[model samples]
Target: MTDISTTSRRNFMKLAATAGGGLVLAFSWTNTLASAVMEVLDDTNLASGKIDFNSYLSISPDDVITIFSPNPELGQNIKTSFPMIVAEELDADWTKVKVVQAPLDTNKFERQVTGGSGAVPHSWERLRKAGATARQMLLEAAAKRWKVSADTLTTENGVVVHKASGRKLTYGELATEASKVPVPTDVKLKDTKDFKLIGKAIRNVDNYEMITGKPLYGLDVYRDGMLYAVIQRPKAFGMKLKSVDAAAAKAIPGVVDVVTFKNNVAVVGTSTWQVNKARKALKIDYEAEAPLESSSDHDRIFKELLSSKEATVRRKDGDVEAAFKKAAKVVTAEYQCPFLSHSPMEPMNFFADVRPDGVELIGPIQTPERARADVAKLLNIAPEKVTLELTRLGGGFGRRLYGDYVLEAAELSSIVKKPIKLVWTREDDMTGGTYRPAVRYRFEAALDAKGNMIGYKLRGAGINSGNPTREDNFPSGAVENLLIDSIEHQSPITTGAWRAPITNFLAFAEQAFLDEVAQAAKKDPVQFRLELLDKAKNAPVGAIKYDIDRMKGVINLAAEKAGWGKKEGVSQGFSVYFSHRSYVAQVADVVMKEGKPAVDRIHAAVDCGIVVNLSGAYQQVRGGVIDGLGHAIYSNLTFKDGAAEQSNFNNYRLIRMKEVPEVDVYFVNNGIDPTGLGEPALPPTGGAVANAIYKATGKRLRNQPFINQPELKTV
Candidate 1:
């Protein structure tokens, strides 16, 4: 079966351009000299014979090689890894290569957006060929000047060397002639064993800049005469602005103007502080048909939805009713998790300068191409006339995918007729956040007289959140009689993808419930999961998307590393999950802290299809473990009368440094193309911690954010 995401080819290594000047290797067929050189290189006729190099690689006259990273960097280290992919094939001097964010141009690089942890996997082959194509061109150019066979010569550290003649030429010296060399439709890639910059720890391109507090982030961008702007959103969900008295807001010192748009009131000022200060004074009236709905009401609705027998069964395989009737014992459990906010480290903000001709937007946006087109359409201009550039994002975690913030800034700039930077206060972000939908899951299982599982049923309810969790996700094929059902209720609450999307909650609910099944079956949790995975691998009843063997491998590996049953004093819990095409298994060690469970250490085993950078991969796993643990322990977005109750950090609690646990990470080194590392590591962590907490206290806390129960705190 062809994988559409990977096999769909795009000419990324086409049309390169020089930033300053000289030989950026623009792969234009119109260049006669380039066409000739490419014909000579085409003697090998590699994978594909369509040479179209996107504008990414460039060489300045000073021999400075710049690689424009196509994906947005949301601190996932793509700025380092993407360049490393090219550098490995190009054999360029790593120290001399500089990486930069590419402007939003889909024509140059198809799908310049970054999400789903696909940056490396999607462009791995294209980038390697892109770099190799340039290297071969430079070698060919050097051979012409040195009067030597290109094959007889070798390249190293940005220089081509004719060892037999004791001659060498720098890439800079031959870049001019190399620019005329036609790009190979396909180029020979390096063997994995020969990779230098890849699969090795390399510092991120912006590490030094970020550590030294350099101006590289969106918030750091400054434009002269750019006014600061803040929007006052409706107080409640589905509410509309009725009226606004902006007299006091306009009278405030340094206040520029107040503009009422379709849904929001914007206060413009000389500075962010002044804008925020004046925003509070604006007497804005909001109107709704009835009282805004609250969490209390939503909870009641969700409970009813979960219990309702009328639901669309996503999948079914065998006789579920017969299996349940034949079972010796049956058990059921319920789990619920409240709404969650993205709350990225950096508050949402974007800078826009709208003009009659077009608009220029510079900010931390994950989907810049989509944002640019949306802005262009709203402004009634051609999409080509708009340019969107990326800046370093403090954190994305799926938040930057939405371009509303970008549009907000662009709309404000178009109205004010000046460059504007619209900033969302932490309060605004928390309240208006596109959150992870609150969910409720009810699971049922049947066991025979021998305690072997026979039947399975799952019914889940969520508000405005679709089944991001596929019905065939996992454990679906492991059972003989299985059925998956879901009920989704529409709501005014805005929700978007969170870390692992649906798997974030699904893993917790399913894994925890599976542990209960293990207890009833008289088996260890890890061993029980492994048993089902083995069955799924050997005798799959349906089309299972996940690799059961890979899933079992990580579970066994994590259990082995954590000494699953041998931990003397700590209560251990194990969980395994697959998401974003990667499998992760985690073992959480918990101990009684005060009257509640506290995490002591976490062991993670990941099979993310060949780790790109060991250091970066490790950090991703560790960070994901910590993040999942933190959210599982304490994180919830509540609403009262459709108004967010948790306004800021004061109420929206996050994990503190003192609460961090020692984390150990391991990777399964199967030589396959890279898969996602960011989100796959997160889902299992929640399940591991939740199960550990259950083990420590023998309390099944069905709800998320363990802090929901006051008994979790000693004070």
Candidate 2:
């Protein structure tokens, strides 16, 4: 874990307060309302004192800018990409802006959580408006000095320029005057075509810091007089901690204290290595629950879900059953996807300093606001007393959302009555992770006599990693007649969100099955999709959640770029999906290498509205595609008796450099609002690759980790 003493929490807070000039500029009406809402929300405890936006930014007299990002950046380029949003709008010199993790104070900073690929898109408007407003005020100050109308002065490179008088002033020169100016209520924003820095390719702002080995990650945080903690959780789900003999652990060098919490015993020591060593030295005994003692028992739950009659209907279209009866042929296929782990390169770690006044938490957590509430509730303290500090994550992949490790660290600090750091070894991280729920989907499609698609029915059972009922506001009512049903297989093992929005894997299964139906009809997959899109666009079957035109645009782009219908030698497959308000379509080119399927290239087309930071957007699309390939081909979390079966990378494989395909990403040229890129590219990759594999071998591999299935092997 990071040494917080060297980078004292108090010192970091002080620097945050004075890092930016105290000039609150209002650039647009939307910003004015958002700023007011933020201030009101910050002052008033909402959602049980969650973290809010005010905690992140502070301007100083010197005009320096400091932004406290609450989201843990796990190698997703968030540290650079998110900051770019602020710099672009704030009109601050990208070079001069300093980024730091926000201290967790649920009462002061609400909603500091970052997940669901929302960091850039959600904050885009707010951060930009904040910057633009601030710039306008500074320009006003410069205009006053030059005896020129504010309209005559403009900002460039953090300087106010008066063209007529040739007068110039740095933001620093007008900091005091700008601070006193009335925050503008109506600020004009640049059009998409006029964007100077937003659409341009820029290197990560924190790239230098990372390359130089600066203390940017959660594991690098440290504190004075802090102890290190390690917890030993149950080896199997549903297993209870029977007993533990700490004599060996206590006798270990540098071991300070040993204590048992709710489910596990923690070993505390002077250093992380010491605590880890002591944890291993300690002899632990667990009473395994019978249901969790075997892998078959866990598999039984999935089997039960597959056959269970009690299923909640997620979406329903026209008479699917009647449509099936009227069809000339009905093709039915069942696809299965296994549970997965986020397994970010950086293991889970957090530092907590529990003092009488308040609790301080530092970690790579996705939701700082959630962390604040959890810590406060667990510690029986006021939410204001708990402060969460977000740090750079090695990688999130939807793993950091749990905040369980953060809670463990706070518990340790409270027990030890001193500052402490909790570090999870790779084994601890992998085993204790909140896994992506294993899911099974059954798809049936019917075609008319003319080989024209008629009706589609999909039924599936999976653990609703999110609110499966679609009752949650974000994904609530996203699709219609979709018939996404789920059963919560209650297990002691934790589960949470993954890369794409909920049901992404299911969508892949559904869309890929649609491709199969197209093949059964001997119709072009792209044309079949366009036909469905036309129906969904003009007379949508039900809810019509997606933007049909945007979806069609991406498919057309991918098909055109991949030389659809004309490409030869390599088998081609296509899939498209929408999530986080972004639309994406992908085509995979595959070839058999040594009797093994190898993806040679992927043609990806996306319409995320407007591109903010084109290079970063491209990187995210490419990264997400690679991520999808890794998950589909290599990643799986199996269980035996309720415990995760894979322990480390040695057993649980990941896609390597050699397997990475040449990715061609093209953005649809349309002046539209910006959406998220982090996850949109991931959902379609599985189906696209699956489609290509089918073309290569004339076989449909519906199961995930496709390499493991015997059916995937060619004759």
Please write out the lDDT profile of model 2 over residues 462-481, one tens digit for every residue: 65454433322111122232
Q: Tens digits of per-residue lDDT for model 1 on 1-715?
A: 1111111122222222333334664322122123212232121221354445444476655677777666788878778887787778888888988876666666656667678887777766666666788888888888888777889988888888998878888887887778667655656777788877777887677878778887777888787778999999998897889999999889899999999998899999999999999999999888985558799998898889987887788999899999999999898998888888888889999989999877888889888888998998889899988877778788888888999999999999999999998999999999998899998999899999888889999988988788734788789888989989998888888888888888888898898899999989988898788788878878887779888878888988999999998978799988899899899999999987666678899999999986777778888999988888888888988899889999899999889999999999989988888999888888888778878877888777677888876535432
- The TM-score obtained by model 1 is 0.92
In candidate 1, which residue ranges exceed 4 Å CA deviation? 1-22, 26-53, 162-167, 180-182, 593-595, 710-715
- Candidate lDDT values, in order: 0.81, 0.73
Candidate 1 has an lDDT of 0.81
Candidate 1: pairs in clash: 12-54, 13-52, 13-53, 13-54, 14-52, 14-53, 14-54, 15-53
Most lDDT-accurate candidate: 1
